[model samples]
Target: MLQWKEFEAWVCIEGEETVEYDVQTSEDDRTVTCWIASELGKKFSIHWKNKAFLQDVGGSVKVDGNPCGGTISYAWRDLGRTISKSGIADAATLKSFVFSSLEVTDDDDALISSSSSALQDLGLLELTIYPVRINGELESTVFSRLNLSDLKVHERSKKAVTQQIKLAEPQPLEKAPRVLDIERTGPEVVKFCFKYRPIDVLRANGIAPSPSRLKRKASAEPPRALTPDDLEELADLEEAKNLREKLRALEKKLHKRDKKPRIKDEDGDVIDLTQNGARNKRVKVESDRPFISGEVIDLT
Candidate 1:
């Protein structure tokens, strides 16, 4: 028994709504064949019958509400009809089907025809048979039919449809310079290796040191010796010190004498302090004579 399964229907009816039919033959031998019939007045009548003799056909039929009489016919051996029956026998057997037809007018002279015997070899002729049938009887009818040429089975292992995406290698991080773990010391300890005699020699001589190194060394070691010329210069300084002391004593004596009381006459004579007590007391004298101890005085 011929098996029909996997049926699919695609129908395009011009000026009419598309209709789909899914029919499956029962596995029981008693329900092996069936007929689907539709009648819409005198305009159209479609009859589909399935028998044990015709089992490889399955497709959809579109009846025009105003079909031209005798403009279309169905051949029992047509691949479309065979596939239509096969599709109805088993819903799982049919793969795909399309039925399309175009109307033609008497005034139009250009007619398109497509002969596709190649589609019949590959089972695709079922899709083209209906359009060709209607095109045969109508004027100015145009029909286009497509046939399968190559059946290519892709090997999934050959290559992936999309290349395997690879993440870019992470950029190597820059390495930081290795820092030495040095221990810090105090400023005095840090100066341990520094030369100290230069500064010490300058301080001993009571001379300020310049930032540049000295060209000549006055003394390389401590406790610098004094030459005879240096001793003579020291003696001169001692003598000058003595003179300054004597001068300071004289200035003290002069200050003490000026602090004492003194008397002076109009003629600028020094007065004796013991006799007249002029130094201790203020006295008025007559202008005619100045007397000392009751003696008459004469004008000079």
Candidate 2:
């Protein structure tokens, strides 16, 4: 989250809070920048909140240099969102944020400057918030839909990003009223930018970790104490692991013992020649039991 005084903002993908890396804030604390991973076909949203609403505040959102809409809230408000898409007052459609891959082209002429202007701000989701005061009553106005396909350019212009915002299936949005007369109350404005790239690109740039790497999140709560039952269960599990180790060791020994060869000698005794440590190992066999010429006997 990007926070300035009581105002804060962040981006959410499919209702999930993504990991933000390389977070940097200006010395004046008015501007913040961070990196996030964007997967293709995933939907995302921008959210902002103000804890201490002492004055009327307004915000504007832009995705990939495309201005979505301006949000004007009444005094002493808490939360708001960037208008991704809008419809006429009588229509029933809303806009959603989706990550989409750019279609590459092989046009040599357009490759040089095809997407220069578009890709410059292609991966940025910026929000600007500032104090505002209005003079006239609010009027209802509809947002114009933006067609992304019409902005296609050569793939070389994509820079470090290959994906752009893709609108999902139309959803419903709350009715909004536009402020007719509004002016900034302060000279300074707070800005937050969420820069995105593909997951592999982020990992290669050391902005994100490799897949399935060991990771831990920071938690405010302390570790919980272990109960007596929990300790007992842990002890039992350890004992079981030790027993399995011992059983494996014994089985290994038995297998080695069975692999040795043994045979009876000329006398009524069993001679074991498999033992390399001993010069000649002999076992006493029953004199009454007659042994065959090639009969084998175990001395171990």
Q: Which stretches of candidate 1 lie over 4 Å from their true place?
A: 1-220, 262-276, 279-300
Residue ranges of candidate 2 with Cα displaced over 4 Å: 79-91, 112-115, 137-142, 145-149, 173-181, 212-300
Best by lDDT: 2
What is the RMSD, in Å, between candidate 2 and the native fold over all Cα? 22.0
**Estimated TM-score for each candidate:** 0.18, 0.61
Per-residue CA lDDT of model 2 for 74-101, tens digit only, reads 5544444232222122134566778888
Please, what are the lDDT tens digits per residue for candidate 1 over residues 1-300?
Answer: 112332222222222322222223454421222111111111111223232323222223211111111111124554233222111111112112222212223332322122322211211111211112121222222111211122221232212111111112223324421112222221110000001112333344434334444466577678969999999999999999999999999999999866644455666665655455665655445565555697765322
RMSD (Å) of each candidate, 1 decimal? 49.8, 22.0
Worst 10 residues of 1 by lDDT: 187-196
The stretch of ten residues in a row with the least summed lDDT in candidate 2 is: 81-90
